[model samples]
Target chain A: MTESTNTPVIVLRGLKKHFGVGDAEQYALDGVDLTINKGEFVTIMGPSGSGKTTLLNVLGLLDTSIEGDYQLEGRAVNTLSKRQLARIRSRQIGFVFQSFNLINRLTVIENVALPLTYKGGLSHIKRLKKASEMLATFHLNEREYFLPYQLSGGQTQRVAIARALVNNPSIILADEPTGNLDSRASHIIMEELSDLHQRGNTIIMVTHNPDLTTYASRVITMLDGKIASDTDSLLGQPSVEFKRPLAMVVRPSTDNQAANSQTKPVVTTLSKVDRRKLKVAVRKRQQIAKNRAPARHAEEYHQ
Target chain B: MSRFLLSSHLQNARHSLRSNRSRTLLTILGIAIGVASITTIMSLGDGASQVVAQQISNLGGNLAIVRPGPSRTNFLTDITVPQGQNYATSTLTDSDVAAISALPHVKEIAPISVINSTITGQHSAPAGTPIVSTTPALSSVDGLQLDVGQFLDSNISQNTAVVGSNLARIIFGTTDALGQTAYIRGYNFTIIGVLKPLNQPINYNNIDFDNAIIIGQDIGRQLSNGSAQIQQINIRSDSAANLTSVVSSINKTLSAQHFGDKDFTVLANSDISQPTSELFYAVVGVTTSIAAISLFVGGIGIMNIMLVSVAERTREIGIRKAIGAHTTDIVWQFLIESLALSLSGGFLGYIAGYGLAFMISTALPFYPSFNWQIAAVSFGLSVLIGTIFGLYPAVRAARKDPIEALRYYS
Candidate 1:
């Protein structure tokens, strides 16, 4: 499916986070402005002390206290109470940490189902089914019964991603998700992320490896707790392409009157290949019309 | 989020306690020792008090003993009765006895005249055998029923003497010391009767009737240089219920007789009952304090270990807070853990205390009486101490900054 041209899912303006007071004060985040669009695969790049994790924490609503406005899906997060922030974090944003942060006592499936359990909108059986489905997608079906310690680093991270995806959050914030993985495992993880992005899921990952930027649609570089550069890929197009099928296929009917109302005459003769091509073009046009319907309705309401 | 916090708190508490089993056991032991000490002391105290009351009751519930003060003597010390200094004094003579008998609630007034005399029988017994000279009223007032033969009569003129059962058994090989002539201080006296055995030796005037040779009061006085003086007055109340009133009246009368100087000391069963009770209470108090100290120490140990646990699980605490654990939740977690440790220790200590008390009571002369109130009070104090001492640490744990705690590696 092709990505929808939706508004930015995350918006941060003049964000700042400082620690300590007076002369001892140090900036963990300094006047940062950033926007992450829906269905975009974005990667944040920075050094160890460059506030990459701190930015992720702020974006994930794990840390607050900044001199800025953070709007997640048009809701101002900075002014929200702790409970509201928690609700937003649980429902709208998912986080994947460097250390995999799996409760060691919980099994793999239980760890994956953590977010769903916290959100608590589904029955126990349904949650289990969803969790199993998600784990199967990650090829962790057999490992669902194993503890975190029993799984390899890659398996644990896959479990972590499954957990992040369980709540169907609007945005996934990953801080050094590949920091502890080897090259092979890192590629496997990046492939999973690429597939998620291809499916129109928004992901924001922070990494120090510059080569991993090819997987992202946008790359944001941070220096000294501030954004230094932001760039979008020119040629690394998304893998999935949306195309709807034509609804014009006709079948002969025995009842002439019924057929007359349900079917239309073929006015021109064409080859089978040409007919299929014309149908594809018509379906594409119809999909565009369908996509623009909501915008048109909103515009009419504004008038 | 609240569920996560609760589960995490419980998990961490269990983990910390399991990780340091030695410390937990030691703390429990300290508390147990404290409880055991207090319980044992209390049990012994109760036992001793009961023993005293039982012994006193056995002697005579309504018997009141009247003794002279520093200046005057009673019937046993009356020198004019011929018994000399061995007798109390003429200050408590026959007239005083007659006057005491006339008082209200007075059942019988018996004046005892005692002397130190040596007697030779089949074997020579120990010196200082009490040779008591008294009237027939002595038998009734002291509740000393004759074992064999009859008690001495005031009208008897034959220089006859009655021997205590123990004395008779020792000197004559049988309580049938009747018709046996015994030499007392070079005087020949026929043992015409045998007195009954009284389990407890008389302690009022340091007299032991087990070795005593009893005779008629007038004859005894006449034989001992005519200087007989009453050493003690044994007054029996008409009824057991009137003991207190009789003792008070007798005290007032004696006090008046001594020119309002209050020289004579009057003793009832209750007066002898106070010491054992006081000793018991004092022991209970002392033991309870000791137990309290142990509980305090155990509570402090719990706090110490809890503080360490908080420090160890700083990151866990931060994670819990980040997930939505309120300060109150954290406080409750730590407090619950402390209370659990102390309360369990209290229960174990109580069982141990009871066991120790039982063992000691069986091995020693004291009989232990368990008090549920003491256990309840101890348990309450343990919980209180746990809470009081655990508060600061729990609050400190709860108040830790989530950011800083999250950053803490260790």
Candidate 2:
């Protein structure tokens, strides 16, 4: 998990992001100071309203009107013009949003080629070729011509990932990538992310689920717009205890049929006892989802 | 702003606009209407000018006209018949005609005296039938062809007449009206000849000769109480080479004849078509400007629809910005979409406008002219309107905050 030179890819110092002014002011990100090294798969976990997405957005350079310094690869972000920052984002940063914000009108290949469109020199044919190649890595080559709505939840998320990596950005920022996926789909996404991390790409992912952090080399937890815990370990050890067993907790399922169809091949290889455990885990996650569904809606509204 | 990015943006703009095919087409239709009006006006105006020019060229280079108008009127004010006492005071006398005929290189002289009177034969003519009183030389000067019988005799005092084919039909109910008597103001005059049909109604004379009754100057003076209004004089030079010298000599002689009043306009060649063409242009210019106003309103329609489009595509804008599209790129995208709509409209309008012009030309004496200048102005106007009307909405899209924009789900 150790990067050879330990070169810092991102640096944030006393960064503050606030909404409104004076009496009505509220901080979305309050004085965050952190340094992420090259090739680190850092997972950020926090409850709702804890500023995880805000931090991710700021780190991705999607938000730059903050109080303090932000440096990406040793260049201060504040000094760059909006056009320059956008250029940097196009060339160096890849973003994955929770909703899998694939343009609904575009075909999957077109959606994946979007980032490369902002790139200056690459021809249209070359960009689509690169997108096709990226889709192949995600085993999504056959679905290139299909629209986003035509793809299953897992496939849509994979296409989103393909779009993110198509530009060969230096860092990937994912905000709740599996937030809408079922357990088996989440497992597949996590495996793909782990494969990317193994190949030495810097990835920062935000997630509500604690179990997903096991794939990360380091973990950070936020509370009330500030980081409450940061740890560099082989496996993430979140300070907050979850209601379910650590090994048994699963991603909340949004679509049961899609989840079942996707997990069928993997489920058949498991033993009878493990299959039963999987079913039990699924049931608990469903119950947790029902109880927490309204809160999730409220949180999205606040965001 | 590279070519690749621009092409991609154009492709995306096409895709997005195609998604709302009806709205795009409607917007394009608005622009097309504006362009169509302009093209139609321009084409028709040019056609009228071309017809007048064709008429003047047909008259031959040696011909010169002397008309009762201000010798030195402002060209701008004279475009629509300048308001003045020149018409009431200016007169062409017989001595003026005699003096012009004595000028060197003057081949012939024909003075036209218009006497307003109703003629009656087999049928009484319309109330305002023009009774033109001229000499026998008018046949050669005005290019009057004798369809069946002889022209007017040289005897100035003879009570003889000639009838245009149309007038003959209106009076005698036949084209061969030689030796037929026609009554004008209680005087019976024998129709000595029947003139050929002249299809051209719009000419320097502004008279449809096909509908005229021509009589000898002496009898016309008796009918009009010896004070006939001499409206114009047609002069033919000996040859095309001597036309300039003849015109100058006649101008000097006529000015001296009127005691240097110079209340006459001597016109030759293309100069003869100027007044008529200018009058045509003024009328067409007014109608064209009205059509231009409608085009401006169409541009406003484009602006209104573009604003609506920007609002609906807020989320799309957000997604693009979030994916690293710059503010200028967003502006270019929307601008290109509007340009596509407007340019397509322009192309459609150009074709439609010409169609309308040609259709209208069927009822007109001339056909509408088509040229590259009209096409260039039309397309240039469309591009300008698209850029201008598309700008505000594009800037509005570009000004959107990525965070707030992404929050827009629709």
Candidate 3:
């Protein structure tokens, strides 16, 4: 696992995923070879059953049964054990599903910070602080303690996004992020991801509506687990451009930096000014948790 | 599994139980009822024996009662009574008391003779007024209290009698009815003294002193067919420390008198109260086992509800696993919830059980005894039931595939 600056974050070659047996068999992902570099906002567009989600799941390292040379950051993912694959999934990949699957009984912060538990380094308080900062970025600071059942469709998706980004994963794989949301909510979510892309975070989104492809740096349409068409010149040229100065762009590391930045990852990416803001965010959240600790104690047995 | 993960599992379990309030309460109620039954039975058994033991201890601690019945000591052997036996075989006689009195360290001997006959008072005499005849040493041997009249004196051959307060009031129209003529079967007797009211009605004698017509052994023989059959012989040792020597001497004398048959028992302290105590333990054993069956059924009910919960929360399990929960974590969640339910039921049932025991004690003679050992047992049994029955559902929950669980709609 060499720390190479020019290495691609995701590399898939001759990927084939088969389902069922004999005559009844069909390929969910037949033969797909794809390469996604660092900070490339790749949008996968295809109709239903076009293997769009299967490709995203394979890239996310969630299901590893495919017969292919699937290398993530110069390391062969197939060679890695289940525990190591889970570690890669936790630190490198953040998934946002169409259903916005938040745990029923857990609160907003609990759902957001769940990925950090698998990564395992910071205390519960520190993890909560980091989750709170992510939620605050999406203007959901006050809704941190709310349950998933109490949230609307749009709010639930935003909380799910916050949960995905809390672990500071290099790539965000969204399988129909706005599939359940209204047009207005969908626009707000796309704008947040567009801003994240301009700040050099790689995003691979799967969508049914082609209107969402405008936010992608490279729009790749799939047909029968094969690339039907690809707008390849947009690899470094995303349609949605940021007005903010690119001078504050942080160098995104491709090595195993995800597992090491336990104490702070947001700090690792921020400039001096934004870094202090994150510190204050972490401190304020800790204070709020200290204040809410007594109330949480009362509700602990009741819940 | 870290401390935070364990705490999270417990918190999720509590939340799951709290979601469906009525089902949780009903299940808890079932467990509580089961727990209360066993606890009440055990407490009452302990309490009754405790009260009897305390009462026995209160009586100078130097007394031992010898009754004419089947020897409980020789339980394995088949003992029979003479033919045509009524109430109990009259195996004791007045000579037994006299012979026991001659033993060393023997202070006093009271021989009890029984005669059940109707009495006619000036106003009214109770239909079942029993006549108990004993020697003048009865007051010293038994803790008999007199209200305002004198007991029968052995020096006098006069047909005198002492009536219980209730019987005296009925037969003579007053407890102070001194020298009032009362008809016993066919003989008329003068009531010399009025006995005190004994609140304790049913004793080992199976006789209520409050409704008894007490007379001397001479009158008892006359009331019967000129033959007095002693029912029991009560001996009072000089001191509690002298009980062993006194009992051994009495046993030796009785053995010789019975021609080495040893059918009669010479008891001291707890030995005298064994028959009733053993009866209590038997009753408790039968009732506790029945209550245990109810608890087992209640445990099954918990398992049934937990299985339903696991099935219903399949989607929830998927969401948790997707967010990074291990398979063992799901199992821990449900097990904790079941434990919470039964343990809560146990706590509530313990309080209710003591309440039941206290209510029963007032209706009966003995008081309910309380001990921490039974409390621990009751609580521990409910917890054990919770864990033992909750296993199947928890394992089922943990074994579910994450992909399939997520695909489930409900």
Q: Per-prediction DockQ scores?
A: 0.08, 0.52, 0.19
Q: Which segments of model 3 are wrong by more than 4 Å? A: A1-95, A113-130, A149-152, A164-178, A182-303, B1-10, B36-50, B62-138, B148-164, B167-173, B176-195, B201-208, B211-238, B241-301, B351-378
lDDT of 3 by residue, A1-303 (tens): 111134488888999987889999999897788878788787887667778888887787666789889998899988987667666667877878889988777899988888787667667798899999988777677788999988877788888888888878888889899899886567657766766776778889998754566566677777667665555532343334321111121222547567645522121222677556545534543354355432233222112
Model 2 regions more than 4 Å off: A1-5, A232-303, B61-122, B127-144, B148-163, B178-193, B213-290
Candidate 2 is graded, for docking, as medium
Best by TM-score: 2
C-alpha RMSD (angstroms) for model 1: 17.9
lDDT of 1 by residue, B251-364 (tens): 777767667776566777755432222233444555666776787787778888888878977876665554445567668778877776777677787778778888876755
Ranking by lDDT: 2, 3, 1
Looking at candidate 2, what is the lDDT of residue B117? 77
Whose TM-score is higher: candidate 1's or candidate 2's? 2
lDDT (Cα, tens digit) per residue for candidate 1, span A1-303:
336355778899999999899999999899888877788887887666778888988887777777888988888887788767766766777777777777665678866765665565565567678989998777778788898898788878888888888878878888788899886567567766766877878889998765466566676767668775565322233323421211121223447747566544322233567556656644544454455442233221111
Per residue, candidate 3 scores C-alpha lDDT tens digits across B187-230 of 87888778788765535444567888778887788776877777
Judge candidate 1 at residue B77 and give its lDDT. Answer: 30
Give the residue spans of candidate 1 off by over 4 A: A1-10, A35-41, A71-93, A103-147, A162-171, A191-202, A231-303, B1-12, B35-276, B363-379
Fraction of native contacts (fnat) of each candidate: 0.05, 0.70, 0.18
